[model samples]
Target: MKSFLYPNIHPPSFTWINAEKTQIEKVHEWIKPITNKSNPVECKTAEIIVLGVPLSRSSISVSGASEFPEAFRRSWRSFTTYNLEDDIDLSSMEILDAGDVPMHVTDIRKCHQNIIQASTALYNHFPASTICAIGGDHSITAMMVKGMHRAYPVKKIGILQFDTHFDLRDLSDNGPSNGTPMRNLIESGDVNGTDMYNIGLHGFFNSQDLKNYADEKGVHYFTLRQMRKAGVRETVHQCLEELSSKVDVIYLTVDMDVLDIAYAPGVPASTPGGMTTEELLEGVLEAGKHPSVMSMDIVCLDPLKDAHAQPTVKLGTHVFLTFLTGVMLRKV
Candidate 1:
């Protein structure tokens, strides 16, 4: 195994109390007690740090997704869940909102470096705790992967990308963008392309060349059609089995575009036949069952595009809760 690199970067300095200035303060209050200095006698403290990397115009129009972290925080205050039947308790989990990473709005490269720096800082303090990153765009996923590799230094890391698009676009005339996160990670050699698995791929947008490239790289491509044929339970089981054997750690990345446009209209990209929100929840729940999952990210939320902010924040909150539930369940 390669030795882990501990970067001296640090999370932006801000108090959680300042969240009260935004609509997400209510959500902060809800999870604050559990994440407060007083709770969690046995459970590992979350430190629930929130790092917002709102990088817009990254070779794609989904640039509006940069507002997701703040939007999610503001919207989570009103969000509620009664999925106790599924073994989830929002009250028991410790979640801290660490705030967003500071970045130069006009500079994509600088923004990317800022994301890596902030994420590396948080990883230093909470190497074993969950770090929930809100999206500026999908490009941030590459840096998150970088930070995880620097911290864990595993020989093999499995990347589970749930999205409507393959995000396999190579570096272009404008450089890397949200659509090229996976490709960037692979190109940078931070993650083995062969160990990657992309789920929820749908639509007619993909070409034969893209499919062949993914296959040639040994990236496991699981289409929605195949998953439907195998059934969610069996498909998820098989994915876990394969990933667990091939990698020491797993990173779960969710792009909201994977959900149907009707279910998630707030994303930069939308596909009509995408997975339903319930299906997404179930898939995440199942993925979380795998003990090897090391970190997770929920990206591509555009509050501006969402009507009344109904599903954008709601969906984001649910994903966050589902991720927490998955992490907790894995501990058992």
Candidate 2:
């Protein structure tokens, strides 16, 4: 793993604050950084393995999303491993932060290939762990899911995509951008469209042709209005129930643009009328507790575009923690 891994550490912005935590109760105690080379880590023994992939060169829009992982670490120090609302403590959980994936500067294709290799290696080596990835763009998710498929060919994998756009853009004229991941996955036979489900799809970001493609491919989706009308909890429960029965495992990929722009304007494609922070959290929580969920990712957010305090990054981090909160309940 060290051959492909880059060391991760607490950002200087909050190191002083984190120092206080390292002393006693560890106020900002979160994941254990796998920073040692001599002391090799066995990833499969951990309950959760978190990895960062900072490859945003493939986004269709101009982006600084590659900085998201470090920003997340900074925000991570502001919070704790305890969920006050649920009275759950994650400090004892064997979670390994294996650090960020080494990415190519100008080679998008190379980056994707490396991501696939990293994902396959992680999933293959850590088959017993829940692999949670932090992405540089939605494109990385395609590679992540594909990697999982490569690692475990016999397992029927399902996708739970929470986003506004269909992410099925035609790539005849374009390269492998974030918009084309799902299409590539579907066309390459890496995943079956019948096993995929999209939630929080709203706004007019997608086209009729894309809708036709989705319908023809048998992809399941729920519009923002549809989920709201049916109730977030009920709709998500329905999706999980249907997909879990059909597939051996589910992989959740959350595009931050699914969030309302007011809550997450950092994402290039985010818009109004998308899911609220609370709504998205509820859906993620549901996925976290499901026995079939093997992996998950949060993507499409650029920290550079966020507010002065970077609320969107912070909120995204919260979404990550909320997912883990639900995961803790599964133990009970």
Candidate 3:
């Protein structure tokens, strides 16, 4: 019986996203729990606490994505707390930053367990709060989903994934990587296959076996071509309508590689043609509006591989903020 490790890493303070020093407060200025501190600032009032898991060892192909959490936090200033689309300001929103889970534990199994245990604690402590786990890779998705289920075992959990690949492959010789999270989740019965809704799956990035598995297990999915024909809004509407009827909760996960390579060249599994940033953002916003969506994550923004301007990180931050905007609207 190996207990997970917890390291002492001080969480970074939120830098105000608002640069103009407007009367409206910025998201960066929001207070968060200091890492490893027993007495974190009063976060019970927070509706959401964002946690980072910078473990990339499970990624089958690319690895440097462990850098996304810090990079995303650094890019927070580029966004505004004001939600232009929903016409809402989040200055009044109580947000807590719980800092990153230490990645020093070299054993991938221990790392995975650490994520589950930490996430479970966060969710249990803040039962009313949505835990947004920033990923080191898609593998973290499995851990977070499990943690959420552990916290609320009575409810049926659903998954809404926006990505180019199905990520349904079984474990390889190296064990569970980013490619296996969905498979692991379904197999573990944490989420019923039919309750999992995936959008924007496309290209040669996936294989027939994985696609077959998705269909065989009754996973609801819309291909990128289908989404394009039906429109992003319509596709998302369909996803929400179907999943909402079947499950008590929805967990939204977005892999940045879902965006076209032009938009998100920094991702570990980026492809040439995929959803536009606006489409992905729209999907996220729509997903957030659902009452059933309890937690969310955005993964695969590798700063180490980013372009000079850090376009992926910038867009990723926008999506993150915009999702919060949707959550604010939900409160209204």
Candidate number with greatest lDDT: 2
RMSD of 3: 3.7
Q: How do all models score by TM-score?
A: 0.85, 0.92, 0.91
lDDT of 2: 0.82
| Model 2 per-residue lDDT tens digits across residues 74-146 | 7776787778888988776777676777777788888888888888877877888999988789999889988
Q: Where does candidate 2 have its weakest 10-residue lDDT segment? A: 7-16
lDDT of 3 by residue, 70-176 (tens): 88888766666777667888777777677777665578888888888887877777788877888789999999989888988998988999989888997754367
Q: What is the Cα-based TM-score of model 2? A: 0.92
Model 3 — TM-score against the truth? 0.91
Answer with 2 or 3, whichever has the higher TM-score. 2
lDDT of each: 0.71, 0.82, 0.80
Error of 3 at 223 (Å): 0.7
lDDT of 3 at 24: 48
- As for TM-score, the candidate ahead, 1 or 2, is 2
Q: Write the per-residue lDDT of candidate 1 for residues 53-156, one digit (tens) a residue.
A: 66666738745776676677666556553356575555455665555666775887887887787777667666666676777788889988887777667556
